[model samples]
Target: MSSALAQTLIVMPAFNEEDAVAGVVAEVRAALRGVHVLVVNDGSRDDTVGEARRAGAAVVDLPFNLGVGGAMRTGFKYARAHGFRYVVQVDSDGQHDPAGVPKILDALQTHDVAIGARFAGEGDYTVRGPRKWAMKVLAVVIGRIAGTRLTDTTSGFRGAGPRAIEIFAEHYPAEYLGDTIESLVLAARAGCTIQQVPVTMRERAGGTPSHAPVKAAVYLGRAAIALVIALWRPPLTLQPEAGTTP
Candidate 1:
């Protein structure tokens, strides 16, 4: 195992994905060598905990369904407490490809945060209607805020280096859409450099999808609200962790 792999942790946030969690964990383990895989079971009523453990992933069970942001915050805290230098967010439903993780981690060498972008000319992933328009607007808006061009600002397949790991471990927002949208604003405001790499997204191996085509319009409104909330917040005062360059 390489030194970088040794210091990295893959944080999978699972919510009622008992059927797919184990397979996703196994795929991630197969793709990334010598990296710790921690699955945060977000109050799953099913056997997500047992499935993850059987798949060789360490599990952290939440008391209730705190959403992705809350579950991710727990993952960040685990990464921080356990002395991991990097944390990559992977979905438990198997949409995110594990093979793309190393590209994200490589970007984190210089950037404080790295996103696995879907619309960067490397994948067949496509969205339409209000959700698509909302995503484009968000990319432009948040891209300007971060002083960099971003093709997919709302991508969940992302990684945080040491500096961002320290900040997110304490300040990651738990609101709706906060994990992807608000969290970027928070990291950028906290003086974290953000970047993205092209990655292909796959269909979910099992379980029901979270978003439906019928909810695209609602998603547009909520996305706009989330962006506003992110921008309205005051800048975070962040200091670099000891032994890590800012």
Candidate 2:
């Protein structure tokens, strides 16, 4: 039983989240039993590594801050190498409620990727001005391309099955919103089952969000270009499955 639990890895990508990493890791442990927790400390200048380790999570200290996508990519590679059957991502900044991770893991019973969507319903997550508009636009564009509606294109709380873990290990993006946006499109194109579940988010455990207003605008433009490019790309190396998880 102990050995079997080793196949599931809960990855937390952290940068300057010292204030939140310990509590977040603790919450994950409390919420999910027997799952291995890994903290990918992305060159945090603070005590993220020390705190996460002290909180009883395995720590992978990156040489530099690789952003969320890059840090998560590294985590996926580790999961792939270690033969983890599932990878559930948790936000180190405490925005993602650890209790919600089980929902994603459970969804993976039928879906290849399960996203904890803040806007799926029953959540207080909302942005203002152009960012909100961009999110709505992205939802439509991605919904059309993915053949399903996805309310939150920027939520980092997600889970991956074996195949997704393998693919993302090799080619996960590392830019602003790169982890959430690119991963969704790639997973969709791969013909993997994708799903979203309603989840309420928390205020950041600590540190600022990546989506500052100025950065959000630049990211909006860049993400738009990327989304268009994704339309022309062929499906991923993994075989596409027929039908999807509702």
Candidate 3:
């Protein structure tokens, strides 16, 4: 936890994940030594806050459920307020592997944002049927919008350097679809380097995935529309005044 070593904060957004939060926190703590873990308990009906706290994470309880975008926004606000130099976003569903944290941190050595691409390497992780199709279509659209080849646009497992964190904290899209894509696109547009690393994703360990088949379809449809709207509008620019630190 020395000042010389970048202060890294790992943000896990959980909703009704009481069964998995403790295990997730333990894995992340073991994998990424010296990193602070912050759990955004997004109004979980279960005892997610208690479990996370028991697992040695700093828990931030939301007054009510605000979806994924709101939960992550809270994490970003915490990162900014606490002066963390790096922020890592990990899914609480247990799909993302904490073991890949080293690769992500290494990638950030030269890149502003390092994303874990589930489809990048040979692994047991598989997104099949309609979900796979939806991801493919979304990836193509995101790549076109960002003018960069993006293999995984929807993966929540990613790392953001201080510059990217400031930008996200200042203007994270309030909507779900726009929130994920806008962060990456904005980082690239601001001359921040973006890179990807291969990582394996596993099935959820506890509660069911929030995105069911029908829900996935609806999300894809909405995401497509949002992407079009986002493209029509100009990208937002970061307005950091001199000597200001986010």
Candidate 4:
């Protein structure tokens, strides 16, 4: 069926993940009911769209690959337009656990945005060598800017409430890994309360990670650049979110 009206929507952004997308979709469907699943097929030159569709998810095909940030924005646009009060983003690579999906959404009850922090509470996700150091640096920088303590600032498993849906749908960042820090900054600046819930990250089910080998260096460079942009961004007077005054 097409985009059905639902209270909560799960958005999975995918690319060249024919093998992984179907399983991820299945797990999500089994873990959560009454929530529509939409997979943004980022111009995959594979069977990602077909597999996702076959596994019972509505699929949206992009003309070209626009990275995770772009795919996620597409999902947010749908959520805002379709009257979804809650939106959860799940990774197609399967690093994000289906069990943690509910935790993120549950945390959104009291907070404007809920992040499944892989290093929060009882997590053990690893960031190796220089990557670990970079993550720590980003944690301090982003946490300071967002005015909240953050762990696993790069984790993508997150849930957003209505106002967050509105803000990101209209003004999402297009930076690499902006899905983490930039999105949080946008929400926090918009007066959204962001909170991190403990969650575990697993190894990717299939395909190589987009940020592998030399791409890791690129991730670091772009994160550094995006950090500067977030720092310079002035907070805007956002509309009321979380039932609080703006």
| Top-scoring candidate (TM-score) | 1
- The digit string of per-residue lDDT tens for model 3 on 1-246 reads 333124888899999998898999999888777889999998899999999999999999998998777888789899999988778888887888988777777777667788888888746677676667877887877676556677888788898877778777866665766657766666666656778898988888786676667676566677766666656667666544356442
Error of 1 at 65 (Å): 0.3
After superposing candidate 1, which stretches have Cα over 4 Å from the reference? none
Q: Name the top lDDT candidate.
A: 1
Which residue runs of candidate 4 sit more than 4 Å off their true CA positions?
A: 1-6, 217-219, 241-246
**Selected candidate, larger TM-score, 2 vs 3:** 2
lDDT of 2 by residue, 1-246 (tens): 334345679999998888989999998888778889999999989999999999999999999988888999999999988879889898888888877777787778777888899887767778877678888888887766678778887778889987788789987877556687877888888777788888889888688676566776665687787676665567677844336332
- Displacement of residue 96 (Cα, Å) in model 1 is 0.9
**What TM-score goes with each of the models?**
0.97, 0.90, 0.89, 0.92
Worst 10 residues of 1 by lDDT: 237-246
TM-score of 3: 0.89
Q: Is candidate 1 or candidate 4 better by lDDT?
A: 1
Q: Is candidate 3 or candidate 4 better by TM-score?
A: 4
Per-candidate Cα lDDT values, in order, are 0.93, 0.82, 0.78, 0.82
Model 2 residue 111 lDDT score: 77
Candidate 4 lDDT over 29-116, as tens digits, reads: 8877667899999989999999999999998999999989999999999988887988889989898887887777777777788888
The candidates, ranked best first by TM-score, are 1, 4, 2, 3
TM-score of 4: 0.92
